[model samples]
Target: MIKDRFSDDDDGLQPLAYNMSHDEGNAANTETLHLNVLEDVHIFTTQFELTHKLNVIQKAALLLQSDTSLDDAPGLSVHEITALANETTHKWQQPWTMYLTIVVTALGAIGQGWAQTSMNGANLYFPDAFGIGSGSARDNFTVGLINSGIYLSNGLLGAWLVAPLNNAFGRRGAVFAAALVSLLSNIGGALTQNWQQLLFFRLILGCALGVISSTLNIFAAECAPAVIRGGLAVSWQMFCAFGIFVGFIANVAVYDFGSNAWRLQLAAPFLSTIPLLILIYVCPESPAWYIKNNDHYDRAFLSLCRLRNTEIQAARELYQAYLQQSTKHDSKDKLTYFKTLTELFTIPRVRRATVAAHTVMISQQLCGINTTAFYSSTIFLDANFSKYSALLASVAFGFINFVGAFPAVWTMDTLGRRSLLLLTLPLMALTMLAIGLSFSIPADSPAHFGLLAAMIYLFCAEYSPGLGPVPAAYSAEVFPLSHREIGTSSAVAVTSLWASALSLTFPTLLNTLGSQGSFTLYAALNVVAFVLVFLLVPETRMKTLDELDEVFAVPTRSFIKYQLTVYIPWWMKRYVLRRDKVELPPVEGWRTEEYQAVCQNEE
Candidate 1:
């Protein structure tokens, strides 16, 4: 070791550690010479890696378990002392500010949910009012275009804006901007007199909703503690399901209002945006956003203190995150939006995150949940239900969708994201297949209608608990802080674009393939979703955002080979064949001790 070396132009900041070598004599002397040169080049040349930060974090968490009195611990306040004392035993206990932030995020989700399913009831009326009720080929395309306008605009324009908005204004500001736009779009859509006018408003609605979706997931994830981050992040999906349920209620309430019912349905979502605008500034800004933007370390610490229950917890996390983020780029290089966007593909770690995010987001669309979300009334009508009955069935569908997602807030952290995807994708495929086959029953039979509705409910139930929450939550958590906004925006764009394609194609597809064939096609796509998730996605539970670098660092080919050669066989022998004492290989790069400690703490 270079025992005591100092830069000639030192400004009084001491070096954290020396880079040591094991060999003695020539190697040691050479290493010392290299270190001396490095010190001369830069005062603090000993860079911090993510692993070093994780190790420090692990030690801090372990401190709560020590028997030594923390009452007099340096830099800890009374509340912070209590907070750390309760952290492991009471994981659910958190600052009210964090929960309030989650509430704001939920409202945003509700607005998007309303935007998604609000059109379900209107689809029954607007096609006729706009003079497209003739059911011709051209009319079908027009209805599809109008229905898909939001998604098309979201994919093409809004999702891409996440990076710029977030970079310039921060998460809270971006969300506030989206809420204002959402309010305007809702009013414009409600008042439109023609399909073209409605389409234009819906396109604008898509832009607002995309920004909300892209920003809030990252916002919630950043504010929440690692122990319960999954639960908080998934609130987006759970409340979105609630929004769908409430949207259906709005649809039913306004259905009897003569020809104005569709307008009322479109206008209902504006109420959710109103509160969002008022409450957004009250919530704490994301600490990660502060760290990523300008190394506003003091501000980030203050933000963390508000989000966490104690100052000590805030300080520890802030320091860990700060060190991890500092290593991403040189201190001298300036970060730009375009450079960040390109890094999503060029950097190996970022590229893997991008790939995994795209896989889940695209799979979310192809699984066909939105097909039902956007047109359940139309689907029910095709089953020979009356117009009034179709709307009622849709209300039921919306309720089931909401109820289905309630379990994920708990399971998302416990079962792990990849596990939930694997477990539910096959079930979704089976349910979609059942829905298609149910049509073979005679129209007059009660079982025909009952079975079709049951299958649809089952499909949504499976989707809500798994795919619905996983896509956005996973995408938000996987990327490094430096590229988070750009990465998540890209993933959301893929989802929106795919949703746009699905929406535009479905009406034409439904006309050509009939209900049975369309459902069957989606069933096959669910199977594809299963295979993609199984092969590409990795589990992300109970790990800090910084620590994920180590997880994704394992090569994809290695991960695949391990699954095929080790994990699959071990699983078959242990679970399927009921064998005893089967030892499975640990996933490459997972810190087993850290995971066990987390599990123990959760208990």
Candidate 2:
């Protein structure tokens, strides 16, 4: 009778057994026997505790069933079962391997930074070497094309190329390929004998940089723990700033090397690529990517184990949680390129995020950082500094940028993204105005030169902390796992487009408007960016990617008010206020039941 009953119960338990075994590996025959006995216990338990009770009872029953001396399986003991249940669910600390992964992956950002600024100081000499006169319309046009060509390629081709490659080769493979391209491109630029060759190599180098920029942040964010994900992801931006600083120092060092100094400057980015290649080889692929895209669940689980510093069972649970959230929108059919791009704009929350991300990226370029970075030396020269002095000033600005980025690493999660941007953008606008006013003074005045340098450094300082890193981090965090690749690529493409436009028009704008007029225009753009951010951008700090998606899905009016009146003021009081006695009153309707329901429904 018991045998017949057990056989009858097996049919009911089959699905549960499969689910458990799918996540927790065990021998087929042993698993079946264990699950049969567990299912018997589960049948009698309350629905709420069925699974937990079954695990506990089955573990104790296995011990009793194993002992042949037991005439029958011993009756379940509540205390022993409870102890086993607690033991089963106990979590271990995350391992050092996860931290190591973030550190290694972030190294690629240095190469990206180097590639960007490599042309900055070197452009001072390009006009003479390429035989392009400074003042003529055709020559300036060619100069603009050569300077902006990389960004044009980056926007038009580079990030688009990375999407399919990222899907096929995995993030690590994509990074390695980008590094290899960078190595060869930098070498080619170093060996170039003519202007055409330099332009060709730089265009190719831009392609490499676009792939790295799009992939590295997503990879870091996917692998990191939620608690520190923003910090680790933005570490790429920090490293990029560090690389630009190094590039500036290299330019300063080689300025005295005469005619070949620019060649050496062009070649310096390859050094960062060498370390990037080495690190990618040693790192593991993104576990989430493996599971969602490749359907390699076991490998994904193992990768998660290493990344989370937990045992297999714990990692399995975490992976399952991620899968549940991610698979809500996943289709069984493979997504085509056109379908993916269409979906990015069609989904409401995703579309909102895409628009916000696009705005931030475009703002980064249009707010005049690229113009400041690419033409700092030129600007200093226009301000009456000697060539060496201009190069040295550029180096000083790079150092300020590098140093300024460090504070974001500490405050990104604590202060929140919205707070950082609100705090910095106003100051950035003021600094731009200060710079423009300074330039309006006589070029020979000591105050004119001193204020120009000071405001430029201040602009770099303001930029690195918020505008520089937060947008990239925010964009990387906002996308769902399914759309992350294409969505981030689109953001990068917009960045490239705006950067190209700014770079192509900068020389002409500088000539037509002069320094004071160009800077005043930038100040106005900053004011516009500040208003857009205040109205649209959400506070995404300390929230998981899944949580952020829900946050974005809420209506814009309620979300913006929650950020401005409730979240920001509370954050300010806690971190910024630093006073023991003062406590801000909470705003009503901030976390009302209706708002919570909306977020939950969207999620």
Candidate 3:
């Protein structure tokens, strides 16, 4: 009878046969067999079941919350409790294998960064070589289109492939496949003889990059402990910044290579892929992926052990992940790719995550970071700097971009995701405005060139720590594990689409609007991005993947209303009005009667 009940369980919970020698009762049987006991007692068993779920949920919550004692946790040894405590107190005290996984996967991001900026110096030399150097409207549009080819493929094809690739190959396998494609595409791009050939290769590169960008962040987030997941997952952005810096260096190095310098720049990013292919094998598959895709508890436990500090810690996490998976209520086999995509918008919790993900991903582009990343050298050359001077200034921009991202390794998990966005978006806007205004200075004056380069550098500094890292990390974490791939892919697709649009039109805009109007337009768009982030995005830092469900469950209107009626007022009183002892009201979750009894207070 108990076996029948377990088989019929909607939550996919296992039977009590795999029992632990703990005092709090077998976690599985407590949920499963307790109902059978109550059936003969003429009791309100449905109410009891609801109360039991709440209790189990609360226990799971404590496992992820810092400063909360785990005295109530079953089967934890003294060493295990100490390990969990250390996770909060010393967030850096992690297993070396976890760090190894972060490094290998992050190399994929570096490859992406290198691929992006490889064309910056090439941009100066290639257009003329390809007969598009006449500076006509048609030529400019063609340059933009060639530059944006990768993003076009990324949006239309690569992003959509993420779900299938991940489903078929898992996170590591998808990365492997993408890396191989990137390697082949880079080689093909370097050897291309014509504009059409170059464009075709770039489109192939974009598809691979789309898969890598969407998968690697999710892998890092899944492998990492909740306490440090933000820091680790943003490794993608940090390494990509480093890669950008190196690509600039490569461009400078190969400038004297004469006619073939552009080809070498195209070839340089492929080197990053070689190391990625070798090192990725050393990293274990994401335990969360294992738990989500199959009933391989032992495999999940083993992966967790490699990633965590202690066996007990791994066991605890493995069980918690299992419980979280059960709550998805549908089997993995039932969730087709299209159904998952549909749920991204239809399910209330998932829809909220989708909104947050799309907001950050789209805003990352609109804030105008890519304007500097893709075309800083062009923009600097336009400001009357010589070719070598423009290259040097771009190199400087790349360095500042890399250095700026270093702080996010600490601040992302500490200041929180939403706080970083709110703090940096205004600065990005102002710097962009300053860049736009710098173009008004007479081109003959050194200050014209100086101010343009300076403002672009400042904008990079502002971007690296916030929008650059937050988008991927935030998108990776916001969705439930069940919908993570499809949801993040959708968000990544939005990013790719915006990036394609920006890349395809920026050169034309520069010609038409001039540098002044283009920078100013992006600055204004940054303000729009800030408003959207403030109104719609929820804070996701320091929360486990499961815990984020509650965070995103709060509707957009509720979140926005709280920001206006509660949080904004408190901030004004406390910070602006110089008031003391003003208390802040907590943001509430969706309060349907069923959830009202079980909802834990949001911190």
Query: How accurate locally, in lDDT, is each candidate?
Result: 0.81, 0.74, 0.80
Off by over 4 Å in 3: 1-85, 89-91, 544-547, 589-603
- Per-residue CA lDDT of model 2 for 69-142, tens digit only, reads 22222232344334333433632234677766666655677777777677887788877887985667677777
- Return the candidate ranking by TM-score, descending: 3, 1, 2
* Per-prediction backbone clash count: 0, 1, 0
Which RMSD values do the candidates have, in order? 8.8, 9.1, 7.9
Report the CA-based lDDT of candidate 2 relative to the real structure: 0.74
Question: What is the C-alpha local distance difference test score of candidate 3?
Answer: 0.80
Pick out the ten consecutive residues of candidate 1 with the lowest summed lDDT: 1-10
Q: How many residue pairs in model 3 have overlapping backbones?
A: 0
Cα shift from native, residue 55, model 1 (Å): 24
lDDT of candidate 2 at residue 208, scale 0 to 100: 84
Q: Ten consecutive residues with minimal summed lDDT in candidate 2?
A: 1-10
Candidate 3 local lDDT, 245-311, one digit each (tens): 9999999999889888989999999999999998887899988777666566557767988998976
TM-score of each: 0.85, 0.79, 0.85
Against the true structure, whose lDDT is highest?
1
Residue 248, candidate 2: Cα error in Å is 0.4
For residue 351, model 2's alpha carbon misses the true position, in angstroms, by 0.7
Tell me the tens digit of each residue's lDDT in model 1 across 1-603.
Answer: 112222212222433233353234325655555445334323212222223223223223323333324542222334555677687679889889989988998999999998888898899998888898677789888888888888899999999998889878999999999889999999999999898899999999999999998898888888888777766777898899889999988888887897778899999999999999999999989998887776676678679889987655875787567546546655525667788889888777788788889999989998999979999999999999988888899999999989988888888888998999999999999999999999899999999988999999889989999998899889988998667778888998999999989998899899999889999999999999998888888888877755788777655666676688778899999999999899976675445555445435433
